[model samples]
Target: MHKLDTKLIQLCKKGNEVAQMQVYDKYAQAMFTIACRYLINEEDAKDAMQEGFLKAFVNMDSYKPDATFGAWLKRIIINQCLDVLKKRKIEFSNDEVENLKVVDDDNWDFDNSISKQNILNAIEQLNEKHKIVVQLYLVEGYDHEEISEILEIPIKTSRTHLRRGKLKLQELLKVKYNEARY
Candidate 1:
């Protein structure tokens, strides 16, 4: 952590309300974006972000210097989002038990290039489980191991979701792009 962050954390740990607000002000927007990726509702995302901040403040004493404060807080925010989703009965399929081979490269070939917006729209239309995996792995820059831990799924399951999600995204984009050309 930078010197400023360390100072802020120390002040926050000391029960300084102003320091707590400073920390919240610094991280809230980014955290809200992360929450929105999962919740898809502005209200729910705000609620999750608030709850995350509360948890972080309450547990300030446990803050470790090993990781950046933002990273630690991001996990809490993600967990808050997941907790809300779980309460809504959102479930991931463990049914993809068969070992399906997935390509290891990022190379993609399309008949015609699709706009980034189109790709993002396709991703938004994916199944909840697949969408979350893709967002965490691709958009959020989390690795498979981190994804597994965050979602509490097996590493293999995380990989399967990501593979399947990409295939699904490709199919969606292809249809859209093909129609646009014709």
Candidate 2:
């Protein structure tokens, strides 16, 4: 059952603790999933979620009810995850990236045998830039234009990192499979 966003916003604005908890409970699972999509590790996702909630609660006054509460929270969580990734300083730059293409290779399929957890684990192995690009492009369904604005990177750089990151992710998955068989 979904609670009305307007009600949640009203209650939150009043500094009601119950309202805050209600908001958290309502969106916690989805928010955690969103965080995981970016961070790719359960622990990191958990951390991002907690930190995001803290930030959201502290700045609850800034929330204009015009937008859904969940959307507001999602933005904070995503930004928090990106900040942590930046602290790690994972590089994502190359002149050769100009030539990397990212056509829809829909043929690349992961059988059900490859668990979602396995795929996410493999993604976590990526550098921060690649991880961010892949999450924004493939997972969140953002285009290069939107991605450029979000990550503040050039559009070309975003596409290059995404393509390169995808190729590397596939290689990681294959290596994991081989190791599992050993």
Candidate 3:
């Protein structure tokens, strides 16, 4: 945690509303973006972000200084988003999601050359299960074990979702890139 974050957290723990607002202002936009990745609706994302901030303030005692404030805030925001998704009946079937071992296409290579927008668009086009796993893995940098814990699935299911999601992404990007080349 930075000096500013430590100061803000200390003040927040002491029930300082201004300090809480300052912390919210500093992290809201980034946290909102994280929420938006999981929620298709802007309003839902905004609500989740708001809920996350409220939770953070309410649970100020749990804020350990070992991790960066942003990371801690992000986990809260992601959980809020996931909660919204769950309320919307986003189902994760163990039997259906298991063992989809799509062979990764090593020949299809994309680096910084591809536009971020293109990749994001492709990700948006993915199914909910695959998109969530992909975003959590590729964007949020969660491992299969952590993902399994978060999504409440077997570790193998998380791996299957990631593999299938990546393969689908590769297929989507291939078309877009090929179109650009020709």
Off by over 4 Å in 2: 1-5, 36-47, 58-68, 105-113, 175-182
The local distance difference test score of each candidate is: 0.86, 0.79, 0.86
lDDT of 2: 0.79
- Write model 1 residue lDDT over 5-66, tens digit each, in one string: 89999999999999999999999899998898889889999999999999999999998988
Cα lDDT tens digits, model 3, 117-158, are: 888889999999889988998889888889999988888888
Tell me which of candidates 1 and 3 scores higher on TM-score. Answer: 3
Best by TM-score: 3
- Candidate 2 per-residue lDDT, tens place, 13-44, comes to 88888988988998999999898777767999
Q: After superposition, how far is residue 23 of candidate 3 from its true place, in Å?
A: 0.3
Candidate ranking (TM-score, best to worst): 3, 1, 2
TM-score of each: 0.86, 0.72, 0.92
What C-alpha RMSD separates each model from the true structure? 2.4, 3.7, 2.3
- Model 1, residue 114: distance off in Å is 4.1
